[model samples]
Target chain A: MIQRKKSLQCRHVDAGSCNACEQELTALLSKELDIQHYGIDIVASPRHADALLVTGPVTDTMQPALKKVWEAVPKPRQLIAVGDCAAGCGVFQKAYASHGGVDKVLEKPDQTILGCPPDPEKILDTLRELMNS
Target chain B: MSEASRVENPYNEWINDNISHKKAGDVWLALTGYRDGQIKSHWLRANGRIDEVKTACMDAQFASLTPSLPEVAWDEREIHDLFGYHPKGHPDLRPLVRTPRWPASFYPMQKQSDDHIEWTDVEPDNPAKVVEGEGITIMKVGPTHAGIIESGHFVFSIIGENILHLDAHLFQNHRGVEKALESLSVQEAKPLISRICGADTVSHQYNFLSAVEQLAGRKVPEMIEWQRIILLESERILSHLNDLAQIPAGVGFTVAHQRGLAMKEMWQKGLSAIFGHRFLFDAMYQEKLAVSKKEQLQQLLASFITQWHKWRKLADRQQGFHDRMRGVGVVKRDDAEQLGAVGVALRAAGVSVDVRTLMPLYRHNRIHIPQVTGGDVEARFQVRLQEVEHSIALIRNALEHLQGNQQDTSWSIPDDLTGEAVSYSESPHGLNAHVMQIQNGVILRYHVKSGAYRNWPVLAFAVAGNAVADFPLINKSFELCYSCADR
Candidate 1:
């Protein structure tokens, strides 16, 4: 059965990223790839969000903050990891302050997009897939 | 202890004299030591650009340089934070990167302390201080903001719509990157360094590789040097486009913002199709396959250039846009210099200090540097536009050279190299520097002083007296990185 999907109201959490993921994510809202036109938009608050778009290796200092953001989102919300750093710590694996990745602090992510910073097209495609499923 | 007496600390005395003579930019502190004895500190003084170094040993404590040079305060605090070196006379000795969450006595980078031990959270000290005045209100924003950007906290002391003062507290994104590199080899540490600031990866990687190459007395092929320049210029174009979009967005000019965004998307798409990563992060790590789509990339850029010119012309003619940006968030020339502003902030303030032009390394040393004296948001925006034009010319020149010849792509670093070296590159944001002390090819201590680190304080200066609503326009004009600053 196809999932009854319409629009996704996403809230992005930067657990401990290097700002690369933020740049590409910002590009998704640009004119060329208007993810909003595809019924996908990044909302301001977690309460209004249907999914959480997370980035970074979940630094120790940010772990609690990340969890709080997760709790703020309503039930049945999806968690999508957006970069190599979010999936498995990437280059900051052994960092003293980092808690490895998003999964280390939270449960397993529903979707993972991999790259140093995954391209906006790939991000858009993944979001489209997530919405359909 | 008199100025004339060359007593116990001769190096400190010389630094005092040189700073008194009004040559602050030329004065630098070089602290060197290997896992032993009192660290040898040197005052690297430059007289009319002629460099000289004088060494001195610490006697348990030293007079801080920040008393004379206000710009040196942050570096002094960083020194205190990292090596546990106390700066006796410096003001605001509060920890910068190491927040109050750690145990009171622990210094992560100091020798003999095992930094890998589990950290326990302590109550964080109030990040913002209360400003008492008639009708004064204080507001705190972020570590998590409404926008899709990195984390930073801004404390604004306001009266009605005007901002009386602003303080920025960063380091929310700090992940001990420098500490993480300590146990890794030079080859192993390259990946971590490149990601220091995602937009400026090419420049950061270049600085690290160049530092290692210098330490090992090795040289990259001339063609490879030219290739590095092309990549740097390409990255600059993409980053400038992002900054350019913010100016229009700040003023509610959606058409101009969208137009700039479209060009930026095309530029990234061209790079991705040719190089395989939109931001070209992969290209920095390995050799590219070949320039199979040279014509296609060229056509894409050519169209982008045409579109950019059209949009810029339209935006420039808009009276409302000019009125909004013309005099907003002005950083005077003196304030920019005193606060150690770099890149767009410095250049827009009419200060001619660029790392590429100052220390020429690339094949194309004749790159045009833009300067606008207004020191406002419009000045910064103008600087970005002119720089885009210059980068386009640079990329074309490098591409023309690339079409003529192909070079072998194989390189390696030897296992054992022991030396301390510093290298810098002109990143899109500003000068990105990497100083590494290597002991037997493994990093002993690695310090990254990014452009964001120097420029974050300057933003606080720019926002003062401006209306609260104009803060975003002013802040976006600088376009600094929180992670780079925090690291």
Candidate 2:
């Protein structure tokens, strides 16, 4: 059965990030590759998209907005946690004060692309995997 | 008594004399003038001074120290900010990374026996005169943007089109490294450091482990040392690649920038093949591949090198790249020095200080490292590309000498030691400096003065007089690591 692009809006959040993922995401939407290459469309409103391409770790403070965004993304929509912290909380998992990792917030990630701020390979790979299915 | 108290040597006395000291939460402290890595003052912490101006201090919050020793003040405000003591008369009280909301009533670094209370906030003095100043028009960017980079807002004050001042507003507060890292044992913390910069994870990891090893006074097997240098260099290659790619994008080289982005993915794919992730993260020196790092990783690396070489050739030949980069962000040698910039930013500006070469943390000291000088955006680009070349060569060297030794991989740290230790690594961006005050096998307070912070201020000077369009381009030339500072 086709996953049918799920019915959700995607939001990219920065969790103590240096913007590497943001830059790469913009490049995805760049006129060059075009988001259509991966069947990814930029929805102006979060209410319209299905997958949240969440980057960075789930911050203690960011928990409110993260929850809001996830809830805001519409139900049954999947959350794609990108980068190190989203999956395993990367380098920051050691800091005693973090809410532990992204899992502490989103118990089960719909999809996790782990990298130290993953490159387009991981991003594109997942997009392809989703679009194909 | 610190060396400051027992300074019989003339140089040490001079360093101790002009220095300031303070007692923070019952800990003796010393503030010494820093000169070319030498502390140039007789050090002593401030014992609450009566004449504020006489002591180069003005307000209750900060102390003034520049009038006496010139370059010494570089570390003063930083010392004050990180330690929560006073450089009492410091002319600049601008919180470095600590938000203005952070209260001075409590210090985070002062041996926290308990972090029980709700933290109080302090209000910043908003001046009545900020709206209009000569040659200053405030221009704010972010917490949102056109490019895909990290989140944070930057408010730039421009005089006409030139950026006269820049206020970096980063409170993305993921510092939860001290917090995030708590559940992790040394085995896990070892790999997490690699993710700190995303670009310099290997370098960060190496330095982190090296610091831990130093704390424990343990040495890795000579073979692991060799493996570390190789991984460090591979990490350097991609880091520089990202910087090269970003510079073009910053300057509106749409096609060139996209190509750079695509090119980065290719290199990352090369990394992913060997390490199972795009970032080559996780333990590259897996127990099975530990001794055979050179044999296993090197073979894999050699396969990628051929592809990378071709990509480099294509990137180098791109006229559009040449057009966009050339002389943008020209950090002249004198300016670079006074700013005390490190890494490729310094090298591009003609200051050849590579921590890998200057203060090698491991095999870096033993191995031969390459050096370059271009001092411009193009120069930084050239330096990075050449270093990537050198990195490949160094990895090959590691492979030839790759041995399997588990001695260094043991993730053990030592018991409490209140003394201070400073560790410097040549991160892909530049110098990553970490100062640790350890107690009971835990870091009491780890103060980081990363290359990002050093290069960030100088960026304002570089962007000055340049067109507003060039701001992003100029900024990318350095690609300063924010994680180091954001932490």
Candidate 3:
């Protein structure tokens, strides 16, 4: 297990989402949540990220990209699967185009936030815990 | 088939006269022309009055309709990719939904194809069309972009910062949602339908349920219709507000961007308080709104309008904001009409085409379809701002209609009701249509052609001739959903 850090820099990889999780993730940037204040930043590049925040049931087209993204993230990285789809493919289970979820492609995520789309607060809390732990 | 025995399809005539004679998939092709009011299939199909023209896919190849119907180009390409129905003369028949990784022989939508297939890791040749010439720089943008956005690959050919052409290769988020919905009961498919596109959840749900209800021959109660209208409008408000926020962000107007997002956040919280989901997913399945919740919504909308007016005043005062938007990314009216643009993109280009006007629920109500003539980022922005106000008015009106109307909200599918129908909803992006075919009370074939899918190609048109720096602003102006389009 990777050591807990003071801050977490996450690069979001949308393997194959309905974009609900991304919506909530975008909500984290709102003044109400302002996750940046908590020392957790959703960076642009995986190379600069300490964690990979992945959403969606991993699609066949996205699997290779997801793997490449994971590899691009530097060492001591945590993979947090956001939403039910990322956790276990949700309604998309066994669908032809998808590899099911993040776990199927990137092995197991370090943490999973469950909900059709976990609320902004839940996502923030999970990141906060990851930072502290 | 002899002409004497052949039952003449009015739809065929409608297509021939209005749209195209390309005998590919008439019903499927009609959706592309839907926003222009040139095609009418939803109500007729719902009433079981329209005869579907079915073409046999002999040798898995069909005549391309793209030569005649430029609007149905994407539909034909998608058909080629998913169902293996080759559009023989399709102008640019590179893979659409199918990326290079997907095996050439495997068609996911085909009934005989296995649900799971071995994926190839080998990087194949880039099938994306490249414009090579002197003094032309090719900039390839992401399937995964820098921002918290959905995946879509864009190839821009530029001559000294001015975009010569843009080839947007989308469907990176093709999760086979339609295929997954097949064989599932309407009830089971509800969740997936709502999840098809998060921002357009209510729109997708409205379309899917409308199709299901039409197939089941169930007349939804007025109260439920009003409730759905409120949900859909609320969703519209949220969606438009998001685009509103992003446009300013693209132009680096920090104050407007932050303020817009804050306002949007407030509305999201309000929606969550009333509907249970921030993005309003599965909102239709919720019980009828209580009087208290209705009052809460009224207060929320009232406050939002006040705040919106204040923001609009501030935004209007900022000449720089207007300067950045005005004359940037202009999609001409003629281009918009010919390309079959919908919603803000179409309306901004001076075409007063809104699917909501066609919807029976909104027809009785005072629905003002907003339009502007500029066809630029500013015009689209203005259209959205106007739409937000209209949506608020619509919600308030719907609330008034719902008050004291304690009608039955419960609905069930008729036993063994098996049929196919098309339903359209005017989503914030544009017109979203769902074609559902059922057998034995379960989905046999489920197809969704979202607004984003139709408008995506229009973005390529809008972006060309604009500086690469303005691409984000132009893209944000359209605000097409990648996942929705891909799905």
Instruction: State the lDDT of candidate 2 residue by residue for B1-487, as single tens digits.
Output: 3665355433333333334331121111123222112221221112311111112222323334454343334456554554454554455656554444445454444324435423233332122112367667787665433234565557777787676656665544445454334334455455555555656666556656656666666656666666666677777777776777777666566666666666666666556665665665554435335453345565667666776676677678877777767777788887776655667877877665565644443534453334545566778778877787777777777667765455544554554533445555677877665544455655544445556756766776787667777877778887776666565
Residue A36 lDDT (model 1): 91
Model 3 alpha-carbon drift over 4 Å, by segment: A1-4, B1-54, B113-115, B124-126, B290-292, B405-410
Report the lDDT tens digits of candidate 3 across residue range B173-212: 8888888887788778888888899889999989887887
lDDT of 1 by residue, B1-487 (tens): 3655446554565455646534656523233332332343333223313233323336545566676667767776766765677766787887776666665566666644434555666533335655679999998887676769787767899999999988777777778888888868987898888787787878888878877988888766655666777788889999999899878998889998888888888888888887777777646555443345557767877988898889889888998998899899999999988877888889999987776764446535686778689999999999999998988888777667665344544556778888977777788888776778898899988777777787888988899999999998898899888877776
What does DockQ give for each predicted structure?
0.63, 0.32, 0.71
| Chain A vs native chain A, TM-score per candidate | 0.95, 0.81, 0.95
Q: What TM-score, to 2 decimals, does candidate 3 have? A: 0.92
Native contacts recovered, each model: 0.61, 0.39, 0.72
* Backbone clash count for every predicted candidate, in the order shown: 0, 63, 0
What 10-residue stretch in candidate 1 chain B is worst by lDDT? B41-50
Ranking by lDDT: 3, 1, 2
Which TM-score value belongs to model 1?
Answer: 0.92
